[model samples]
Target: MDVLISGASVAGPVLAYWLRRRGFFPVVVERTPRPRLGLGGHAVDLFEPAMEVASRMGLVSALREARTESELLVLERPGRPAAELRLNAVVPAFDDDKHVEILRGELATILHGVTRDDVEYRFGDSIRTLAEDATGVDVTFESGETRRFDLVVGADGLHSRVRELVFGPESEFRHDLGGYFAVFSLPNYRRLVGKIVLHLGVNRMAAVYPVRQTKDARAVLMFRSDTTSQHDHRDVAAQRELVRKTYAGQEWELPRLLAAMDDADDFYLDTISQIRMPSWSRGRVVLVGDAGYSPGPAVGGGTTLAMVAAYVLAHALEEADGDHANAFAVYESRIRDYMRLCRDAAPRVLRNGVPRNRVHRAIAETSLRLLPRLPDRVRSRILAGGISGALSSFALPE
Candidate 1:
């Protein structure tokens, strides 16, 4: 079978790897001109299942070496002493060997490298239109080339062009989680080494964490908004201004972070939204990862879910002997429940992370401060019932 997958960052490449391993020819179309090599993006977590998938793909060693050594987390409030805690205290799952944390760009580069030789990657091009028929999918590229494929998979992220073309408008499937965020890299002015400093204010927060080397650091700024107001998703200048306006005149490194955000080269801002769909497939076309169901960014184990979804998709296709109908059905059935569990937690997390008022902020801080001191069994029970547990709910098909 000849399969065309869109958006090569994480899901596309992983899907390509598994499909090729299943004796299927895979072609990947990425909008970016080239692979992101050590670019600045937030560090993402991989739990038990994603780690298992990496092991199967022969990428465990490389990923282990790429893991971020974030040792401490410092939470600061206005006119208050900064609270210090171990990074694993806030995220207890990381204390175990099953959870791995690495930079997003680094993970993308690794996945692309592992599959580049086997997969046909068309960079600097994208599908302008997709016409699906009983036999195959006829795709037209932005560069004005046309091709037909046995199947088309949309691995694109939240604002997926493939999903828009095949499924519907993004607004139809997008569920606003009531916030916005921006991520960028800056000079390590504070010289933070294996430490993360977070500053929280009413309805906003800033997090600065050291990167692989102590020379540079990654900054994340998040703010809460009440309404799902529309903004240009592609306008960099506009997005920057929005961030600047929203975070104007805050305390604890706000001015410096804002300055760095303006000067930073790789500034990316997006609304924190989830993609909820009734079905992830339609005839010969199907969706994978954030393209189909994104339980918001940052929270929800999105990257891990994307990798496992790609693995399940390949196995389903192979098991069904290229019957896309059966394959897509099984793929959705296997992942729908887990995806829902992840999505359901997004709002609660968003509210807690970006508190609306002082009361909420205090409650959030108190919970964080007390989480580590909880009895091991109580914490285990809580983790098992929360988003972290939903991450490893599915076992891969052998």
Candidate 2:
């Protein structure tokens, strides 16, 4: 079968890899002009199941070597002494042999490296329109080229063009969680080595961690808003202004972090939202990863979910012997409950991570401070019930 997968970041490549391994030809279309190798983004966690998938693909060692190696976390509050904690203790799952946290770009580069030689990648292009018939999908590219494929997979992210073209407008399915997340790279002036520094405030948080294998660091700023912004996601200047206005006069390295944005080349800003859909497939077209069912960005384990979903999708297709109807049905059935759990848990995760008031912030801090001192069994239970557990809850098909 000839399959055209949109978006080459995470799900597309993984789906392409597994599909090719199962005797199918997969072509990937990416909007970026070139591959995003080493173009640093946010740090993403890979839970047990994702790690197992990596192990199966012989990428565990490489992923481990590329991990951010953040050993310590420093929590800073204005007019209060900074509290220090071991990063692994803060999230015990990070200490587990099954979990690895790496830069998003690095993970993408690694995944692409394994699939490039075997897959056809068309960079600097995207689907302009998708016309699906009983036999195949006719895809028109923005560059004006047209092609037909037996199947078209929309692995494109939250604002997926493919999904918009087929499923309707994004706003129809996107449920805004009332927050924004922005990240960019800057010089490692703080000289933070193997450490992550978080500046917490009511309704807002800023964090910086060093990028492995470079003298650079990544700055992440998040804030809650009453309503979702109407700004275009691609408007960099407008996004920067929004961030600046939201974070203006903040304390503890925020001024410097905002200043550093002037020189930051890879700025990304998006609403923290979830994609909820009744169906992920229509005829010869289907959606995967963030394109179909993103719980929420940053707060949710989106990276891990994307990986596992892609793996399941390719496995389902192979098991069904190229019967996309059966395969898409199986794929949705296998992951729907897991997706629901993630989606339902996301609001609480966001509320905890970005406290709305002083009381909430204090409660969150106290919980973190007490988490490590708990008994081993108690800590394990807590980890199993929290975001870590929800992310790793899925059982991959044999």
Candidate 3:
């Protein structure tokens, strides 16, 4: 079977990796021109099973090569030394290292490398049009090549072109979580000690954390904003201005982060939105990762969920004797519970971070300081619950 995957970042390459191992021919199309991303930064929580999936692919050692050190807890101010919350415990079910954090770009790069030899990757190009029928989907790319494939899975992203062509416009499936998010790299010039700093506000917040293995700190700026309006994604100048206006008069290092935004080589600005789709698959074409059902950003274990979903989808297909439709159904059925937990976790976390008032912010900070005082076993149990809540429900086929 010939499978066409859109987006080479995380889901596309990962799905290709498993699809190829299952004896399916996979071709990946990416818009970026050879992404040279680095590892060792911004810790991402990979559940035990997510790690197992990587280990099964023989990429665990490679993943370890990119593991960013985890040492820091958030505070309410910069260098206040008022109070600090220690990272109490990391939840690992049945194993201590079951859940580990790695940089997002690092995971994408490694998933790409593992799939490169066997997968057909078309970088710097994209599918211009896709028309799917009962037999297969016909695709035409920017390079003017046309082909038909047995399956088409869109791993593109929140703004999936495939979803637009098949399911309708993006507006129908996208649900804004009432926030705007921006991230950029700032020099360790702040010399932020070994800790993450977060200044909370009503419907807004700012945070800073040192990226591991480099003196640079990754700054995140987020605030609740109206989204009845839209902006051109390609217009960089407009987006920066938007960020500047939205975050104006904010305290914390927001001013400095915005100053770095002009010369920022790679800054990402997007509304915190969730992808709500009734079905992730249509005919032989399916959707994965943020393209399908993003439980909003940063809140839920979305990164873990995306990788696990691809693995289960491929496994179900392998076990289903080519019944692609049944395979797709089973894929969703298996992971639905886990996805629910990730989705449900948002309200509490959002309330804590983007508080409704200063009181909530102060209360949220108090909880963090109290965390370290809990018994080690109690924290471990909570960690287990956290992992189980986020990922334990999905059972992999032997």
**Which candidate has the top score in lDDT?**
2
Cα displacement (angstroms), candidate 3, residue 177, comes to 1.1
lDDT of 3 by residue, 1-398 (tens): 89999888777887899989889999999888875467433456777778878888897777766665544566666545556655424333422456566778788888877888889999888888988787888999989999999999998888888888778888899888777767777787767765677776667778777766677877777777776238665677878888898878776667787898777776777777788888899899889888888876766677777888888888888888878899899988887777777777655555566876778777866766776677877765664455345565556666
Q: Write the per-residue lDDT of candidate 2 for residues 153-196, one digit (tens) a residue.
A: 99999999999999899989999999999999999998999999
Pitting candidate 1 against candidate 2, the one with the higher lDDT is 2
Which candidate, 1 or 3, has the higher lDDT?
Answer: 1
Model 1 CA lDDT for position 301 = 82
TM-score of each: 0.97, 0.98, 0.91
Q: Count the backbone clashes (under 3 Å) in each candidate.
A: 0, 0, 0
- lDDT values of the candidates? 0.87, 0.90, 0.76
The prediction achieving the highest TM-score against the true structure is 2
Question: How are the candidates ranked when ordered by TM-score, highest leading?
Answer: 2, 1, 3
User: What is the clash tally of candidate 3?
Assistant: 0
lDDT per residue as tens, model 1, 67-176: 88887888887688888877676465675557888999889989988998889999999999988888999999999999999999999899999889977899899988
Q: Candidate 1: where are CA atoms >4 Å away? A: 93-96
Global CA lDDT of candidate 1, please? 0.87
- Residue pairs clashing, model 2: none
